[model samples]
Target chain A: MELLEEKIRKEGQVKGEGILKVDSFLNHQLDVALFEEMGKAFAKRFAGEGVNKILTIESSGIAIATSTARYFDYCPVVFGKKYVSLNLDQEIYSSDVYSYTKQQAYKIMVSKKYLDKDDRILIIDDFLANGKAVEALIDMVNQAGATLVGVGIAIEKGFQDGGALLREQGIALESLAIVDAMSEEEGVIFRAQSEKK
Target chain B: MELLEEKIRKEGQVKGEGILKVDSFLNHQLDVALFEEMGKAFAKRFAGEGVNKILTIESSGIAIATSTARYFDYCPVVFGKKYVSLNLDQEIYSSDVYSYTKQQAYKIMVSKKYLDKDDRILIIDDFLANGKAVEALIDMVNQAGATLVGVGIAIEKGFQDGGALLREQGIALESLAIVDAMSEEEGVIFRAQSEKK
Candidate 1:
């Protein structure tokens, strides 16, 4: 988490009041080494949860989920597709999510063949803001009758309520770096990670 | 490559005439161990290319790109964004891609900051069919003045001209599994891997 926080402090750009742009390393352009470190941290946090699968949304979440899968005994990573392609099976568990950043509503789906009651799933993603995407994934997991062991995120916008809401629901949500506040003038402020554990 | 071919032969579903669905391992539900093996194989194939970056499109390609980056000294993995967001920088190298399966055309954008003349990029993708997406990626590489060492594809539809066209252009194209022919009735028939080399 220190390494992530340090990287964010060094390269992260704050745009306006709420947006923290980390495309240089975390989202658009990726640092796989840092992802591996984050993966190890997630594995350590959720050590004995019997996580057999990793669930994530398409686009940004795939890389983080794939990285985290290696640490969980190479658990299978299933990504929820935003666009319903011809290749995707019709038999899928679908949920609606509204992206605050993109300002649009989209359906996220996972083929029913991938998830079931016997699987223990861990959700992973790059960023957590309003938590709509994570909520959609959790909904799919519930629909499949699968148990969600935990949620692992690379960065959490703590100023937003997504992370807090999950913690209130007694879900084990672990974010590597939590930004409590941000501003163009004051830069980005992070919540002490020590407060979580 | 044998391991991947075996996985496809076992879990891959041949739908109708051309569609071979390997979502069980490659696309939707990803097997990280297999991906690591694939990463190693790609590393062996592009051993001395001095690839400093792994370029891919979002959603499906990100996982393989991340997995492959580790072997290339953990080079930066940059994914082209199909859907542009407000957060993405305005200056981008964009290209149009026609998706044969999806029956649509979309723009793939890469931030100008990530790629440049000095970088050696290897494009990684889940499937290579008509090669529109790969062609779009190659265009972006050319736009950025970057060196495209090669393209690494998990599965190439040999029945299609994408793989053949790239080879015809004298591009270093390596596909892990090449399906020469496939049918729902007769199943999938793969071209001999030995014939390529």
Candidate 2:
């Protein structure tokens, strides 16, 4: 977690309107070594939860989720696909997510074959801004009749309502780095290490 | 390679129009253990190429590229993003690719900051069907003046022209499993191991 916070502080760019550009090592460009360490942290946090599956929403979350899956005894990582509108196939579990960034709603789906009642799911993502994506992922787990073990995130915008909202629902969410506040001039202000969930 | 081939034969669905869906392991529901094995195989094949960076396109390719990056001494993995019409920002390199599956063309862009002349890149992708995506990625690499060491594909549809064309160009292409032919009835018929490029 310290390593991730350090990496973010070093390379992450803080832009206007709460935009944190981490293309260097987080999103567009991936750092698998850091992902491995983050994976180990997730594994430790959700240690005995019997997590058989790791769920995330693409396109940014795939790398982190896949790397985290290795620590969970190589559990299958199922990512929800983004579609403007889905065909509502009966063989899949689908959920609607409202993207505040795009100011539009979209559907995220997972094949029913991958998630089911017997599975314990750990929802993972790169960023949890408003919690829309994580909520949709949790909805899919409910649809599959699966157990919601917890959620793991690489970065959580702490100033946003997402982290507070999920914690209110009693979800065991763990974010490697929580940006309490960030500004173009002052840079990123991370939440104290003693304060993370 | 044998492990991957076996997974495809067992779980891969043979859909119409030459679609071999191995979503259970390769793309949708990713198996990190399998990906790690794949990374090892790719490392062995592209050994001593000084592959310092792993390049891939987003969604399907990110997970594999992230896993593969581990074998490359935990190098940076940069993925091209798919956009309908990119803004052509001065900070990015963009390439056009026509997707036969969707019958539409899209632009894939990579940040100019991540790719440059000194980088040795190994492109990794989930599938190489028509090779349009890979070709577009190569175009971006060329635009950035980067060195392309080779390509590592999880599955190559040998019946398609992609593999043949790439090899014809004298590219160091290594496909873990090459499906020479396949059908719902006959399943998948892979090319002999010795026959691969």
Candidate 3:
């Protein structure tokens, strides 16, 4: 977490309207070494929760989920594809996600073949803002009759409602770096993990 | 390679027309252990190429790219973003790719900050069919003035023109499993690497 916070302090750019750009290392351009560290941290936090699978959304979440999968005994990582392809199976568990950034609503789907009642699923993603995407993934898990183990996120926008809502629900959510506040003129302000709860 | 071939032969579903769905282990639901094997195979094939960076597209390609980066001494993995967001920087190298499966054309863009002329990049992807996506990625590399050390593909549809075209262009293209022919009735037939050229 220290390494991630340091990296964010060093490279993260704050745009107007509470946007933090970490494309240089986290999102668009990825640092797998850092991701491995994050993965280890997640593994340590959720050590014995019976996590048999890691679930994530398409695009940004795939890399982080894949990195985290190795620490969980190489459990299978099932990502919800955003785009509907001709080859996608007809039988799928899907939920709608509204992206605040893109200002659009899209469906995230996972093939029913991947998840079931016997599986214990851990949801992972790169960023957590409004928590819509994570909520959708949790819905998919619920629809499959699977147990929701926990949620792991690389960075959480604490100023947003998502993190607070999940905590209120008593979800075991671990965010490596939590940005409590940000602005183009003022830079990012992070919340101490101890102080967050 | 044997493990990958075995996986394809066992779990890969050949649909009608030219579709082979391996979502059980490859794309949608990922097996990191298998990906580690794939990363090792790719490292073995592209050894001594001085690959400092792994380039790929978002969604499916990010996992393989992240896995491959570790084998290359934790090289940075930069993935091209398909959907444009307000946060995306204006300065980027963009290319148009026509997806045969989706039946649509989309733009793939890489931030100009990540790639440079001195970087040695190895392009990694999940599948190579018509080669339009890879070709667009190659074009982005060319735009960056970076050196493409090689291209590593998990599966290549040999029946398609993509694999043949990359080979014809004298590109160092290594596909772990090349399906020469496939159908719902006939199943999948892979081309022996020795017989491919």
Candidate 4:
């Protein structure tokens, strides 16, 4: 977690209106070595939860979830598909999510065959902003009658209610780096260290 | 490679119109253990190429590329962004790709900062049917003046022209499992084992 926070502080770009860009090593361009460290950290936090599956949204969250899966006994990572193509099956558990970035609502779905009642799911994602995406994943998990062990995130926008709300609901959410505040002129302000060793 | 071929034969669903759905392991519900095997196989095939970077597209390709990067000494994995949102940088190298699945055209972009002329990139992706997506990635690499060491595909439809075209151009293309044919009734038939040890 310290390594992630350090990398974020060093390379993260603080933009106007709470945009912290760590695309260099987080999202667009990924640092797999760093991801492995994050994986180990998550594994320690969520040890002995019987997490057999990792659920994530497509595009950004797949790599982080994939890396983290290795730490959880190589759990099968099921990413929710945003864009529906010709190949997607008809029997799916779908949820609607509003994207603040895209300024529109889109549907995220997982094939019913993948998410089973026996799955102990760990929802993972890159960024947890307003928690819409994470909520959508949880909704699908409920639809499939699966038990969500917890959620793991690489970066969480702590100023937002997403992380707070999940914690209030007694969900064990572990974020590698939580940005409490950020400004273009100033810089990213991470939340006080709360990650358990 | 045999492991992957065996997985396809077991779990892969043969859909209508050349669709071999291996979502159980390869794309949707990712088997990270199997992916580790793929990583080692890719490392063996593309060894000594000085591949400092792994380039891929978003969603499906991100996990495979992430798994493959560890084999390449934990190289940076840069995934091309298909959908542009509020935060994408203006400084980018973009290319047009027509998706046969969606039956539409979309632009895939990569931030100019991540890719460089000194990079020796190996394009990693889930499937290679028509190879339009791979071609788009190659175009972006060319635009950045980067060196494309080769391509590593998880499943290449040998019946399609994509794999053939890349090899015809003298590209060192290594497909873990190439499906030569498939049918809803007869199941999947992988191409003659052509993968190097």
Give DockQ for candidates 1 onward, in order. Answer: 0.94, 0.62, 0.92, 0.89
Tens-digit lDDT track for model 2 on B5-84? 99998999887778888878887889899999999999999999999999999788999999898889999999998863
lDDT digits (tens) for residues A46-162 of candidate 1: 999899999998888888888888899998999999988899999999999998888899999999999999999999999999899999999999999999999999999998999
Q: Pick the candidate with the highest lDDT.
A: 1
Residue A173's lDDT in candidate 3: 93
Off by over 4 Å in 3: none
Q: On residues B30-94, what C-alpha lDDT tens digit does candidate 1 reach at each position? A: 99999999999999999998999999998788999999999999999999999789999999999
Best by DockQ: 1
Residues A1-197, candidate 4: write the lDDT tens digits.
78999999899998787788889998899999999898898899889989999999998889988999899989899999996867888899999999987899999999999999999999999999999999999999999999999999999998888998899888999988888888887788778785421
| lDDT for predicted candidate 4 compared with the true structure | 0.90
Q: Over 4 Å off in model 1, which ranges?
A: none
**After aligning candidate 4 to the native by TM-score, how far in Å is the CA of B175 from where it should be?**
0.8
Worst ten-residue run, lDDT, model 4 chain B? B188-197
Fraction of the true interface contacts (Cα pairs closer than 8 Å across chains) found in each model? 0.99, 0.80, 0.98, 0.99
lDDT of 3 by residue, B1-197 (tens): 68898999899998877889999998889989999999999999999989999999987889999998999999999999997888899899999999988899999999899989999989999999999999999999999999998899999999899988998999999899999888887788888868855
Which is better, 2 or 4, measured by TM-score? 4
Q: Can you tell me the CAPRI class of model 1?
A: high
In terms of lDDT, the poorest run of 10 residues in model 1 chain B is B188-197
lDDT of 3 by residue, A41-65 (tens): 9999999989999999888888888
Q: For model 3, which pairs clash? A: none
- How does chain B score by TM in each prediction? 0.98, 0.96, 0.98, 0.97
| Model 4 stretches astray by more than 4 angstroms | A194-197, B194-197
C-alpha lDDT (0 to 100) for residue A185 of candidate 1: 80
Collision count for each candidate, in order: 0, 0, 0, 0
